[model samples]
Target chain A: METLKIVKIGGNIIEDETSLNAFLKLFSNLEGKKILVHGGGKRATSVALKLGIESQMVNGRRVTDAKTLEVITMVYGGLVNKNVVAKLQALNVNAIGLTGADVNSISSEKRPIKEVDFGFVGDVKKVAHESIDKLIQADFIPVFCAITHDGNGQLLNTNADTITSQVAIGMSKLYKTSVYYCFELNGVLENIQDKNSVIKHIDSKTYKYLLDRGIIADGMLPKLENCFDALKNGVNTINMGNTDMLIKANDNFTKITL
Target chain B: METLKIVKIGGNIIEDETSLNAFLKLFSNLEGKKILVHGGGKRATSVALKLGIESQMVNGRRVTDAKTLEVITMVYGGLVNKNVVAKLQALNVNAIGLTGADVNSISSEKRPIKEVDFGFVGDVKKVAHESIDKLIQADFIPVFCAITHDGNGQLLNTNADTITSQVAIGMSKLYKTSVYYCFELNGVLENIQDKNSVIKHIDSKTYKYLLDRGIIADGMLPKLENCFDALKNGVNTINMGNTDMLIKANDNFTKITL
Candidate 1:
């Protein structure tokens, strides 16, 4: 079976030039199929300030008001996307920056939650993998931002992790492979306070046990959920850790299996 | 009369980190009310290549197809705007980055040119100066991307020069002052071949002569038109050139008066 990798980077990784450059270098060296999706929270806040608009965050997520929506579109869709593409180009990597709004590659629905207006936030409703697969077949890495479109023609800002997971699951369904969720940390730790206690492998039953025991808390919950989602949706393997661990399958990374 | 300034920077200036730093330094030292609007055409093109999407440019303007539009939004509004704001913040300059779609401060109407689908491009149709003024009044520099809204809630990419001119004209009308259009060039030259043959001053008649002779071509045409429009719209003085010329009204700068 052909191997395809979907990588999701957070704002911390995307905002730091040195880290981004290193990631691009590794991306250039990688074989097989790969897709990159990035987050833009930090950049969006700065833009909000420049427009003299104050950003309102609810439960650690940016509330996309009309003003915030504009900033998100400009920053996620315009600035960071170009920066990544330019860096890859400098290194001779064929990469393309895309959002859900383009060609409707990823169709989403406006998630209007009761009592809380997320503004223009989107929940990924579907993924049209044909265009993405076509690009991958042509040896181009699709660098995506978390922004999406509601079938009604409005751009919606979605969470990077969710978008990446959806793309990974979608690609996994289309082409049997694995999805890697990489970060600066080593991997998901058995103890929240212990960095060296990497949880090597966890099955669906074990993952639920850890969650029930409160071993996985805070930001790690969403990521682990994404991993499980990918596993359930036909992904062969889900790896979570630093890229170094990914490159070598170095025993330290957490592997989610059926 | 209260003084107001609108500065439009080309993408080339922002692309160079050193130039961008120098611009920020000079920008921080300026007094009175001011706003920044910038362009990012080259960056957009670079990102397009990575996605394997070929950029289409007609008559020197980017033909923003759906994919190109996505790239533009990411590069211009997200990366460039945030970088500018971050640099300014590091330098202790209170700066804010914004797009026209934010706060409805800058609104536009879709261009109705037949047969040419300038997909998601806007012509500045309205300028709400009160919100901008409030920001300036609170001592923040507004760094803006040349993107706007099409009144129908869709985001539209706009021309930086046109956006600057419109904002300047609007502010001048509100505050009764002049607007400065600054660039890297040492003003408009009389002899295209001679760099030192700068036209220090051009009245309406001489400006028309230059246009008729075809010496001022392409992008410069819109720039000149913007200058003329600003002047006609009650902006009494228009200056074009480098920062040095703008600061001191030196020999290398072009001054237009009505």
Candidate 2:
């Protein structure tokens, strides 16, 4: 199988213009088949606040309400995705921006009203791998916003890292897929204060130990869960680091394996 | 060649949820390969105002300054586009919402300052019909919002009618293409006040007479120009009417011909 890379850029990278442009330039330089999945949480929150919509968060995940969904849909699906695509076009990368709603690429169900009614939030049901693969084979790089649709006319806010893993797992059948989780961190750190204390490699057993010891928590917890999910489900490699891990031969990133 | 229909919905339909849903259902029932191009000017304006961005318009064309560009990107590319796509997906149309930047499908250059400095507005340069056709043949209907990209990293506000015609003309090479202009008016009305005064058939000569007589002015002027341009450029037929014209055998439409 030929190589395909799935890169998920977290909200922090997307929040800063300079960092986003820099990341996009490096992303454009990445060879072989690739897909970009992105989140725009910070921008969405700010935009919502400007419109007088209060944002609520529980744990690391957002508590999406009606107005909040519209904000994320506009920010993630429209502003961030299009700008990134235009930048890639400028760099001669054939880019197409998409939400899960486009071409029914990913379908999810509204999270049932259980512990928290994450209003208009979707837990992804399926990824249309065949459809996306066709676009990749035709040489179009897809940039996905962190939004999904329930097949029955509802748009749902989804976790971007989960989207990345689902897409990677789906595509792994056709390619030696590698997943990259790019964020503000150098990598998953043993000590949050010490930049150099990057945990270079982690496996299932080590990850369990880390969880027991409370080393993996908050935002990084859900992200690592996604990484391990991808690895367990046929994805070849998973890397967690800053954008430098894309263009640089950096040893300061955490690699996840099953 | 197989038939391909390009339908451009004026912004009014999109602004009203009921009308847009009615139009989408009518659109999905149309029996062939089709593309839907839409404008969200009203919604964009409203959203811009909510975000405290003043919209400046010169005639019917938006004067897209830096701030206005961002507003449209979020409104047209994100909110309106994604919502429409989700709705169409629900209708089982397999709609893929796009701006010209996606897959490098359409490339435009910034409009030259000839009397009016329409900042960040794009004049249609070329349409990548082949890339679009591949998706069409793959069973995905393209839903284009009136946004285009200059190859140099800028997303420009484009006139939706121009996009409709240009795409039809481009795809006419591979398919017997037809263009539909659906707006608030019944058709090209002989008198602005009379709904029954729709000019049913308009040849190029007749179009000129109407133009000289001031029957075709304001917003309809540039739209008619695009119609004639497409007709001359190998597009087979052009129809201008309200959304009802899509489903009904209505004589309340002006059909353009050479």
Question: How do the residues B1-258 of candidate 2 rate in per-residue lDDT, one tens digit apiece?
Answer: 899999999888898889989999999899899999999858777788888988787777668999889889999999999999999999999999999999888999998998788999999999999999888978889999999999988999998888988899999999998788898788888988888899999998998899899998998887788778788999999998888888766667888987
Candidate number of the best DockQ: 2
Clashes of each: 20, 0
Per-residue error for A4 in candidate 2, Å, reads 1.2
Tens digits of per-residue lDDT, candidate 1, B130-172, equal 7566556656577888777654435678888888878877777
Q: How many collisions between residues are there in candidate 2?
A: 0
**Quality of candidate 1's docking, in CAPRI categories?**
incorrect
Which structure among the candidates has the greatest TM-score? 2
C-alpha RMSD values across all candidates: 18.4, 2.4
iRMS, all models: 17.5, 0.7
How would you encode candidate 2's per-residue C-alpha lDDT over A31-94 as one tens digit per residue? 8889999888578877888888988777666688888988888889999999999989999999
Candidate 1 similarity to native, TM-score:
0.53
Tell me the whole-model lDDT of each prediction, alpha carbons only. Answer: 0.73, 0.89
DockQ of each: 0.09, 0.85
Candidate 1 runs further than 4 Å off: A58-61, A208-214, B1-258
